[model samples]
Target: MSKFDSLYIAAKEKLLAAKNIAMVTHINPDGDCTGAALAVRKLLLALGKDADIYNEQGFPSFMEFLRGDAVFNRYTQEDGVEYDLTVFIDCGNIDRAGKVAWVCEKSDFIINIDHHSTNPMFGDINIVDSTASASGLLIYDFFKACGVEITLEVANFLYVAIMMDTGNFSYSNTDKRTHDVAGDLLELGVDPSVLTQKILRSTTYNKLKLTAMAIDTLHMYCDGKIAVIHASKAMYNATGTDSSDSEGFVGMIRDIKDVGFAVFLRDTTDGKLVKVSIRSNLDVDVSKIAAEYNGGGHYSAAGCSIEGKIPDVEEIIVKRLSEEL
Candidate 1:
């Protein structure tokens, strides 16, 4: 067994010993975090334990296609809820859990499962493997080690998790093992053609409007090396969309040839915070830039949340990216 297998054994032992379990993912949950958390919850349930997922921000609108939407409890700091183990999936640190961090602290045992290199390893059992293309990949390995059968439902969850995190296998993180795992999932009844349509091609009319608004704000800086876009509250209101609708806007700008990096900034539901997503070409390590703002992710894709006016935030980010280039 590899190191992850041993950790999986320990995780399995902990789950079997526990009665109530809470699986928590990071704030502004993405497909990787949501899918990993939900998949693990199902596996825990199969072991005859009570398990549920807690996410501070619920699923993005585009990810409604994934399974287990209702089971996610939007964290509200309610009292009297308890758990023996709290598994943090795809979160680099406890703070990334946002409002759910309190629950993680209250839990008797904590398990941190993630693929980010900057993870702080702040759990009783830390399964932090940066080499894994996605956290769901680690969860898949965990399921295999526990001898849990990969049902069609479970297979779809892991499939979406891996596919989204690897950027449909177009990202550098997608390697031989990633493809092999995807092939296994395909054999288990995951239809790539249908999944691709739902995840990539399918979009709401509101999302298209939001994309247009964001593109209108696009500005290239550092002599076209950096492409930046900003979304404001007015745009959200006009487009009948939220931050989630602008999911792929950064990637849209990233496709521009000769643009070394792309940036997307949007006002949070609470106007106090601006969420920044960064994507980079081969020339830059965007994770380092995100880390400077107390965010973390893969080298090619990363994000951070900043407290400032959107314009100021955009200017500061361009300055930072300029330094990086």
Candidate 2:
């Protein structure tokens, strides 16, 4: 058996022993994080355990279609309520858990479940697999191992998580195992057509306009091998679009012919912080660049947040990425 199998077996026992459980994911949660948390919550509930999901910031509107309303909670430090166990899903490190890190610290036991190579092994028990495309995949395995039934809602959420992180099964992370897991989820009655239309096709007019504007600013570097776009707070305000609307804008640049790398920089709500998402098509490892800013993710697709003006952050990224060209 794999090392992760042993860890999962041990963690499952601890989880089964805990009655009151709390689940958390990283800040600014994406599909994988939310899916993993929600899947685990469903499994725990199936096992007659009480599980609560927590995250500081809310998810994007697209994710609202998932089962988040009842189970998902915003973190607030309460005096008297302490969970017997805290489970972290898809978080690379304790710090990535944001406010929930304190809750993890105070809990009687901690469980970390993730697929990131950079996971810090912060929990009393950890089940991390760098080869998995998404944490939802691991959660699926957990549910199967524990003989938990996979409901339609669970299947849909896990499908979204796997699909998004795998770039609709087109990214380098897509292996035969990823496809097999996705097929299993499909067997559980996940409607991919509905999910695709809802996630990829259903965008507001304002989002479309903002995306066009962002694409207009796309600049080619290194003889058309790299493309970059910057969206300042002013641009977002002028377009009347939230930061979440800028999601997938980087892919527009990456789609360009002969482009090996693409970068998108946008100022966050704080206006002082810029968020960067990088995508590469070839031998370039964007995660290394993201890690320079203390961020961690996959090799081809990675992101980092910078405390600087968009132009300044763009310049630094472009200068560093130009070496790869």
Candidate 3:
């Protein structure tokens, strides 16, 4: 049996043994994180366990259609509540859990479920598969192995997790097993058209305006081999858009014919910290770049937060990425 199989069995045994459970994902959660947390929440509820999903911030409205009401308890030190077990989905390290890290520290048992290669194996039980498209897919397999029914709700949550993490099956992580799992989910009534429309095609007017502005300021570097864009705090105020609306803007630069790398820079709430998201089509390992800033993720897609003005952050990233070019 594979290591994942062993870990899955051990984790399942623990789940069956636990009473109160809490689930958490990384801060600024994406599809994989939210979907995995929701899927696990549903699965634990099916098994007659108390599972609560916790995250510091809310997800974008586009992801609201997934499941479990996206009920995230804001992370705070004074909550004074602890769990028999805490399951962290799609978070590589404890710190990624943000303020919820305190909750994790208080748990009697911790389970770290993720697909990132950089996972620190911080949990009492770490079930990480670097090759898996999404942690939700692995969790789905765990439920299946444990003889849990694959209900429509579970299928929908897992589908969103897998679809988004693999870029709708366009990323290098897609494999035969990924397709097989997706096919099974489809048979179980995952409405691809509806989910796609809700997740990808639907956008508010303010988001559209922000996208247009981002596109207008798109800059090409390395002789058009790299593209970069920035969204300052002012941009959000001008467009009446939240930082969440900046999602997917980097992909637009990736469409540039000759560009191998795309970077999106945005000033965070602190104004002094700039969030840098990097996407690469091939060869260039953006994870390595993100690591330079103490961040980690997949080779093709990664992100980091830098303390600098937007312009300075942009110049630093461009200079660092030039080495890869």
Q: How does residue 214 of candidate 2 score in lDDT? A: 88
* lDDT agreement of model 2 with the native: 0.82
Q: RMSD per prediction, one decimal?
A: 1.6, 2.0, 1.7
Tell me the tens digit of each residue's lDDT in model 2 across 221-313. Answer: 889988999777777888898777887888888999999989999885545888898999988777778888987777788888888887788
Count of backbone collisions within predicted model 2? 0
**Candidate 1 vs 2: which has more TM-score:** 1
Q: Sorted on lDDT, highest at the top, how do the candidates line up?
A: 1, 3, 2
> What TM-score does candidate 1 reach?
0.95
| Clash count per candidate | 0, 0, 0
Task: Quote the lDDT for 291 in model 2.
Answer: 86
Misplaced by over 4 Å in model 1 are 68-70, 269-271
lDDT of 3 by residue, 129-236 (tens): 888888878888888766789888888889898998888888888998889999999999999888888888788899888898888888888899889998988889
Residue-by-residue lDDT tens digits, candidate 1, 88-159: 999987888888788886699999999998888899999999888999889889989999998888888898
Best by lDDT: 1
Give the lowest summed-lDDT range of ten residues in model 1.
61-70
**Which regions of candidate 3 fall more than 4 Å away from where they truly are?**
1-3, 68-70
TM-score of 2: 0.93
Estimated TM-score per prediction? 0.95, 0.93, 0.95
Alpha-carbon deviation at 120 in model 3, angstroms: 1.4
